[model samples]
Target: MINDKVLAIILGGGQGSRLHPLTEERSKPAVPIAGKYRLVDIPISNCINSNIKRMFVLTQFNSASLNRHIKDTYHFSFFSSAFVDVLAAEQTPENKGWFQGTADAVRQSMHHLLRHEFEYVLILSGDQLYQMDYDLMIKAHIKNKAKISIATIPVNAKDATSFGILKADDKNLVTSFVEKPDTSLLPEWNSDVSNEMKAQGRNYLASMGIYIFNKDLLIDLMSNPDTIDFGKEIIPQSIHEHKTLSYQYEGYWTDIGNIDSFFEANIGLTADIPEFDLYNKSKRIYTRARMLPTTKVSGTTLNKTVIAEGCIISAAKIEQSVIGIRSRIGDESTIINTYMMGSDYYQTLDDVNNSKINIIGIGARCFIKNAILDKNCCIGNDVRINGGNHLEDTETKTYAIKDGIVVIKKGAVIPNGFVL
Candidate 1:
């Protein structure tokens, strides 16, 4: 009786070690982006826009925030059959272990997956930043009669080492794959490379880690007891037995896995012309509705900045930054090239006066540049956080410097007159 044939499985809870302080208390997918939405929102919105209503988010590490976001933000209408669900990793008698890798995570949920009615499975990463209509790839798969299809992008040789390089024929069929390939191993443009690729001088096909698989083939491939990762094992092995197609994505796609990469992606948003556009009206990105009031700024010289609702700023020189929801900035503070993740809840005047703990806000006369302030942090007055010059690594119990970017940990309290 079921008509829909595709299933979406979003991979979350991947340790996110590279993005240290940000992922300390929450899962990677739950990490906030564009100052308004979590990284998970990107994939969920893509599914919704594409009319692929069924979804499952796989989670394991620090999933409290991630679970809350999915539950509260993705409630389907009573009249509709579409649903977004979370499948947390569990320790069953048959398997008592954490999700070993990407493939293993899906393999662990096989019991639940097989119970559903679906002909294909689409795997998407939770930390990637981009907009994609997966329905196109699904149609391409059916047209080619492919057992599997991987979404890919063309990258210069300088950027190819960070991704999985794939070799495909003119028919857009995958022939080989190499994960985190070296420049020496990147395939040169040959007769097999498609004309659309234009991989002539230094360009190569790099896997975006997006995949679509026939339900039966996916089930059979995950049947192995040793398959740990898709990029590491499954996809490479499948080249010999199945017809694996390649879906070339020419959009702006980025993987924010490391601290440096994360900072770049966020700061790049303030550019005159950003690489990724969040202002698309037809296919907009979706998020939870907080129902908060409008942001208020007074005597602040703001330029090229994006401020979320429920924020109160005063006499501050802010430029090229993203100020998140419920942020409170005192007078004469300067913020540049920064990302301030405001508070989860509003702190009234009574709450601020009564609590001995750190309330969420930056105090007066603070100068923060080239840094990120996590949620619910209390930055005291006269504090100077300048990471533009600090090249060495410093890990205090409260905060740390990774890749020359000062990361103020979540709920951290910095005393007055401190300098970093």
Candidate 2:
């Protein structure tokens, strides 16, 4: 019954400039991750696992792929009220411009939200990687009789400066808030965290950008157009005026805000025991159930690699990589610390043999390290891309170098013996 009274809004971030080439063609939420799943799948799967089925994803930029993914992936009984919808910004008689910030996006879409029956609104970031049961947060909110609740994670001082830090009382009631506070002010902003967290030097509570607001409070807050962002405006302004509870979550959570974090999150899956467990049956990460065949590999030395379905890998060695679906790697190639987002569709034998173009996937005798191969890439033979601190950041038509990681653009064709 509690689940029925809750509605979820997942905010797909703005242009996602930090994620540059990856967001060049698709929305942030639609960006593929862990080889097969989209970034949006994280929040949607979390909501579903928490029994909160009604959700609306708010996205504006390049949402076509995100729209298609949601439509194809999530399906429920025709008679059931459960559904996931994508709400892109639209020009209206009242507001014409794009979403100014987080609050603005939800404000513009409130008309559609009012039609649904809900008591509380659960707001989530679409670009985050984490697994959590939101039902517990909602329960805490009800028990504490709070008007708003924020999911806070204990972060060390070094990591706290980049987040909206919160100071909570012994009762877990947020007392003060600061957005990306200076390092010098960290001592005054410390919150009482678990002994385990304290031992690890994670003393401050950082807002996870996850919130639960009473339906009435959210509707009231959205009326003020001046307060555009929750973290920047709504939260700091309302903390003193309202009873806001802090729901502490100590889990494997990462905000995939840029290409670097995104790359690390995907590659981290190859760990012997990954912090973000994909093997958990109870908290399964749901995605489109494509009838894909098992990945086929031959004589490849795989070490700490996670390969998705429908891959044909004949690489000499693949170490610490996440190989996606429908991938076709040629022989004698070596891949290390890479995330290869495999092709959308498999290349037919006729096309591979007859076409005077490079094949879709890695070519023979290539050495790719510390890179990301986007979907449907045509890597030529004998290409050697060794990414490291030695190379400066640069971008070309076919690929980009960010923080020493070579990212091959989607559908790009690298010439034979190309070296980076």
Candidate 3:
């Protein structure tokens, strides 16, 4: 096991408006990712792989699904002290307000955190994709004798505007930090991209929103009642006041913050050689193990797709997409460049024969292209959802087009012959 000096806290984030419809029913952390796993699983798996036994996920809005997933999936033996628990927002005598931001979420949960005897508190974002050995970051934090250590990744100037760009001194001590810098100002903020990073076409460093804070220092900083966010408020101020150091990460790291990034990440995983390799044996990503039957396919011409367990595909064409568990595709349907978050439960053959309920998936001869179909959605026959033909966002009662990606809201029913 990694040292007992570190405790991990995962920020589940506030209302996930950007990733709406997906977050409409559950918390952001509970949103399904890569077909099988939830967003919170990434950090929890990273901590487990790093040998850190204890983890606390802070949640405020719509946390029931997240709590249930954690309870059912993470079951350490009774003898082991290791635990993964959800610390949802509560109204205490001192603080009755909801979590204002990431820092405030942790600040409100400091009561439970203070009970544990730990030297460093590792803060992580729930909605990110990347495998990390946090023990290494802990070692570097200790070596630097830092009060706070922010993990950063080297990226090109073009891709750095969406993240919190940071500048470090010659010694790797953080000197300046800016949140979501303007695209036009990227050139001025471009710092020394490492030699190896430059060779990889990277020119600036962007924050991964992963930080390790000395226990006492984190407590002291959060004692301020006015502090709300770590990124926009605490971190920008801490760069000059505290011993904030920068730890470089060279691997694949992306914040799945919005629909465009989320869609790209899921679709990217279906690549011939994906940047984030899920098949890595040693560093594995763990999720809820469902006792579902094998996926059955019949005459379907599938290409570069990830179909989860218990799906039955019939004479359909799927390319460069991710199909979730228990998905059902009908005859002669064509799905391309799409991500379908599959249904929760399957409708049996008996149910289908009796016409008991609507089954989730594409109906006969439906054409879906460049879209994301949420869970438990029903598409009638001859329905066409081709977003390539439309670039502007549109919102109707049944569907919404965000970032040029057609999104069928959860549980929405598209009648036959419908076209977008």
Best by TM-score: 2
lDDT accuracy of residue 203 in candidate 1: 61
* Model 1, runs deviating above 4 Å: 1-3, 187-202, 353-357
List pairs with backbone clashes in candidate 2.
none
lDDT of 3 at 106: 93
Task: List TM-scores for all candidates, in order.
Answer: 0.95, 0.99, 0.96
Per-residue lDDT of 185-264 in model 1, one digit per residue for the tens?
76553224445556444367788889999999998998897999998899999977899998988788899888888888
Selected candidate, larger TM-score, 1 vs 3: 3
lDDT of 2 by residue, 117-182 (tens): 899999999999999999999999999999999999999999999999999888999999999999
lDDT of 2: 0.95
Ranked by lDDT, top first: 2, 3, 1
Error of 3 at 65 (Å): 0.9
Q: lDDT score of model 1?
A: 0.87
Q: List model 3 lDDT by residue over 160-185, tens digit each.
A: 87789999988889999888898888
lDDT of all predictions = 0.87, 0.95, 0.89
RMSD of each: 2.1, 0.7, 1.5
Off by over 4 Å in 3: 183-188, 389-391
